[model samples]
Target: MVWDDFAINNLAIYLLDKPNKDRKVALFVKGCDSRGVVRMLQDNQIKRENIYLIGIPCPGLKDPKTAARGYYKDAGSVPEAKKCEECRHPNPVLYDEILGTPVEEPQEKDRFAEVNELEKKSVDERYAYWTAQADKCLRCFACRNVCPACSCPDCMFDCTKPRWLDKEVSTEQNQFFHMIRVWHVADRCIECGECERVCPAGLPLMQLNRKLIKDINELFGPFEAGLDLEQRPPLTHYETGDPEELM
Candidate 1:
């Protein structure tokens, strides 16, 4: 099976659910997908010994949806996928064997530009802006379904025992869902932008994730998720010297 796209974490579930414990699986991965593999490994969801990674150095990928719109005569005319536009890791960071020459990484740009702008707004203004965005949600779970960080075997949103969320889709419930999801992946998100890319509502989901990402960096010191196996996520790690602003 071939998936030609910017992010490939949607396929990660298959890797995590390997039927045979002794069987080894080989898979092709690009920059973001490789980080997803690392995510599963670091999260202890998968074993490195059971899989072989064939990494591809990605230059970038064009949005297939944009291409499907038929506005462009050539592939070059299609815009690079939003996920790839700010990709800091164009080469796979983890792999058993790699293919192709490593492409030069894209020039660094502020990943939190939208979050920074949102931060400039007053609390009420920010609340209003996000409320509007939340109202547009369809509760389709596209964002959560596409996220590699949302790898739970049984997601709370689907639970009937506790019924965490009401069946009715209101702005409050939608906002609550997003808030819970964003915080859950705050330290685990790989900055792949897949959630925003797949959203049919065109909601700026990445902005919400990046807001927490920016805060995490400032609060925990500079850290990028899914990069290093040795590194523990700031939220999971404790230090006596850590900031205690609320206390």
Candidate 2:
């Protein structure tokens, strides 16, 4: 079988499309890629029985862009990709077969350090911070294209029927888009960091994602999305004990 490096997001995506729906497929997955698979399965976008998974223990990848620019003279000196530095799962969570020795998971660090710091800011300060990020947006939609959770057949932003959003690229419009996008995947985000990595604006999209994730955990008990097959996202299901304010 032919094998080559492929973008994890691309492979994990398209599984939701009609072309792949009926086929029995085998997928090679890293930690992030495996999470995407779990996301699709939990969303009922793909059937687990039709697929085989080969897991790889990821040691994190070097930043190709920086390496190509000769940011480091030696391979060993190249820093790990920013996304991988914060990765909680270095070994695939679900796989039919695994290859290579399982790498030791990184020491648990506070994943929400940035989010917690931002929470200490006043409401106006938070708004100003987000506004600045929105102003830098090019509206290229690269983040959405690479997102595994955004597998809708017809995206609302692209619809012409109601003309929900215009082509205007103002800061206001950009903020609207970003907020809507984040909220849509807030509960289901796999923490793959593809959105921030692919963004041309270099926006800290993960901050927004993690902020929501933090809030969800606090409100509904500690939970991680796409990690368990049986546990549903807290936001997706209703519990009688859930906060009355939520209703």
Per-residue lDDT for 226 in model 1? 85
CA lDDT of every candidate: 0.83, 0.83
| Pairs clashing within candidate 2 | none
- Model 1 worst lDDT window (10 residues): 4-13
Candidate 1: where are CA atoms >4 Å away? 1-13, 18-22
Candidate 2: lDDT of 104?
95
Candidate 1 all-Cα RMSD: 2.1
lDDT of 2 by residue, 1-247 (tens): 5332223343577576687889988888888888888888888889999889999888787555556667567867877778888999878888999999899999987889999999999999999999999999999999998888777778899999988777999999999999889888988998888898878789999999999888888888888887887889888788788875433
Worst 10 residues of 2 by lDDT: 1-10
Best-matching candidate per TM-score? 1
lDDT of 1 at 11: 49
Q: Model 2, stretches more than 4 Å misplaced?
A: 1-10, 244-247
Model 1's lDDT to the true fold?
0.83
| Backbone clash count for every predicted candidate, in the order shown | 0, 0
